[model samples]
Target chain A: MSAKTWLPLLALAALTGCRQDMHDPPRYRAQGSSDFFSDGRVNRPVVEGTVARGQLRADTKFYQGREGGEFVKTLPVELTKDLVKRGQERYNIYCSPCHGMVGDGEGMVVQRGFRHPPSFHLERMRELPVGHYYDVITNGFGAMSSYASRIPVKDRWAIVAYVRALQLSQNATMQDVPEAERGKLSQEGRQ
Target chain B: MSQIFHPSANTIAKVSIFGAIFFAGGLLVILNEVNRSPYVTRVGVAREQPVPFSHKHHVGGIGIDCRYCHTAVETSSAAGIPPTETCMSCHSQIWADSPMLEPVRASFRTDRSIEWTRVHDLPGFVYFDHSIHLKKGVGCVTCHGRVDQMPLMYQQNTLNMEWCLDCHRAPEKYVRPREEVFRMDYRPQESQQVIGARLVKEYKIRKLTDCSVCHR
Candidate 1:
C-alpha cells in the first residue's frame, strides 16, 4: 500500500496501543492484587499494636459495651428515635437474615437450614443486659460470625437499642403503651 | 502525443475520488461500532470467579439486602467485597458439606482472601465513588442493572466515558429516592421525568460534568 493508506492505519494502531497504558496505570485499586506481595493482595495487614488515626476507641463502655469487668446495664449512648431507626436499618442488613426482623430467629437464612437463634422475647434473652447483645454482635455468638468488621461501633449500639425495642414490642401489655397512643391501639384492635 | 493516458483514465480518476469519500466514512462508522461491541467493552460477559456465587439466589430468592454483604456501599469509594466470613455466616450451617462451597470453607479456615474476579472495572483515571452516586439517589439498578436477577455477576453497561456522560449531563433522567437506592426491582411510580426532577432538586444532585470532578 502507498504511504497515504499506511498513514491512517498507523494512526489507528497508535491510538489503540497507547490506550492500554492509561487504562491500567501503575497503581493499586481497591481489592486488586499485587505481584510484589506474597499473598497477591494489594492491601497490607495493619501492624500489631498500632491503630490508625481516629480509631483509638478508648471508650470501653461505648466500644466494648463494658465499663469494668461487668457488662453495662444500660446503653452508653443517648437513646433517640433516630438512633433506634438507624439501628433497625443496620440490624436488617447485618443481623435480620439469621436473627429475623423481629428477632424471633425465624429469618430467611434460618429457614434455609441455619441454626435457629433464641427468640428475643424469651425470659433469658429479656433478662440479659443491653450490653450482652452488643457483645454478641461485636464478637460472634454460637454459629454467628462477628459483625464487628461489617457493622461500625455506633451502629452496633444502634442494633442493640433496636433489639431492645423489638423485645418490648413482642412482650408489651396495654399498660406499656402510652396513655395518648393507647387509644390508637384499642381502636385498631376493635376494627 | 497520442493521449498520454487512456480515454478511460478520466472516468477512473472520477470514480476513485467519490470512492475515497465513502471508504473513509465507512471506516469511521465501522470503528465506532467495534469500539462499542462486547469484544471491546466486555459488557454482558459474565466473568468466571473462584466460586460461582449467585446474586439471584441470594438477593432474589432469599431476599437478602445488598448491604448485607457489600457493607461499605453507602460509606466508601469501593463497594466492599464481603470477606469469606460473610459467606460462612450462612454456608457454615446451610451448605456445610457441599463441594461447591469447599473453596469458601478453605478460605475461611486458611484466612486467605478469596480472589473474586473483578467486574465493572473502570479506567484508573476515572475516580468513581459508589457512596456519592448512592447518596445522590442513583439506584443500584440504574447502573448495575437488575443484579437480583443475574445468576452470575457481569458488567451491565459499557463503562465508557460517553456512557458516564449520559448520566452526568442530566442526572435527573435516572435519580430515584434515596431510600430506593439499594432496591433492585424499584420502578418509578410516576413518570421518570417527574420523579427524577423532584429527586434531583430534593437531593441537590448537580450536573457534575467537570473534568476534575471525576478525573481528580
Candidate 2:
C-alpha cells in the first residue's frame, strides 16, 4: 500500500486500540439478575439485623414519631430558632407546594387544582398531637406521598414544629403574642 | 516505457489524488465544528413541546416559586415534572376554553402524563441527583440559567462533563444560602469568593473530582 493510505490506516488502528470496551466488563448491573446467587438476584439481602452506618434508629419517639404505640404530643428535638427556620425552609420546599405557606390548605398547588389538604386552622387539626404531623409526613396521607425519602428525621420534627407554629398563627388570639410584639399586629390594623 | 507512461497525465493524477485527500480532511474538520456549534447542540433553541408553556408568564410575570411545579426537586433524584392536574388547576378556571390547553385537559381526564421534551439531558452514563444539589444549596438558576427571562425554556448550559467538573471542582463558588436556592433573581451581596468560602465551611462541601461521583 502507498505511504499516504497506510498512514491513515495506522492512525485508525491506534485509535481503535484505545477503545474502553475492555474496561467496561460484562458485569451485573445494580438490581440485575445473577445466576450465581440462589435467588437469581445480584442484590444481597441486608444481613439479618445489621444496621447501615449512620442509620441506627433506636429512639422510637424521634425516628418513628411514636412511643408506647401512640403518637407523642410534643416534639422530640429542641425547638430552637435555627431549627424552626430550617423547618420553615424545608416546609416551603416540600410541604408548601401542597399545604400552603401558612398551612391554610390553599397552597399554589391546591389553588392550581390538586386536592386541597385540610387547613391547619381547623379545630380538629389544631387539636391533633404534634406527632400526628410527623406521622403524616413520614407515611403520607390521602393523595400525598411519603416524604420520608426526601426529608431527614431531624428535619421532619423541625417541620412538625413549624406546623404547630402555623396552627397557632392561624388560630391565635391577641393574648398569644407578647405585649411588645402585639404592637406589630396593631400597626397592620389586624388586631 | 515512454509510450506506456505520460509525465503530464501522471502529474495531473498525483495532484488530483492529493487534492482529494486534502478536501476530505477539510470536510471532516468542518463537519466536526458544525456538530459542536450552538445551532446543532440546541443550546439556546426553544424546543417544541406538546404545549407551549411560557416560563416568562408563570415565573417572571406571576412570580411563582420554582418548587410550585417541580415538587420533588428537594427530595428526589429527578426534579418531578408537574402532573396534568397542576395545569388544570389554573386552566380550568382561567383559560377554560383555550385550545392551547386542550392537551393538559385531556391528560388530566385520561390520567396520562404529558411527555415533556427534556431540555437539560445528561448522558446515560452520568448520574445526577437534583435533591443532593438542592440540599447542597446549588440554586436552580446555576445550571438552568435565568429561566424566568425565557419565554420558552431552552437548554441554557451545555451540561457537558466539563461544565459539571467546573462546579464540582469548586462547589463553594456556586453555593448559596439554602433559603436563596429558589430565588431566581438573587445575587450575592458580597463577593462570591468570600460568601462561597463561608458557605463551603458551613455546608461542609468537599471539592469532588472523582469520576464515580457523577459517572456512577
lDDT of each: 0.91, 0.81
| Highest TM-score against the true fold, candidate | 1
Position A59, candidate 2: lDDT = 91
Query: B92-177, model 2: which lDDT tens digit per residue?
Result: 55676789989888887875567677677655577789998887889999999899999999988888777889999989889999
In the range B109-172, model 1's lDDT, one tens digit per residue, is 9888889988988898899999999999988999889998999999999989989999999998
Candidate 2 residue lDDT tens string, A1-191: 89999999999999999775644446754344567987565657788889998879989899988999899998888889988888888788678866888898887757666678899999999999988889998987777766775677898999899988888777889998899988887988863
Candidate 1 backbone collisions, by pair? none
**Candidate 1 C-alpha error for residue B148, in Å:** 0.5
Question: Can you list each candidate's DockQ?
Answer: 0.79, 0.10
Task: Give the DockQ-based CAPRI class for model 2.
Answer: incorrect
**TM-score (2 decimals) of chain A in model 1:** 0.90
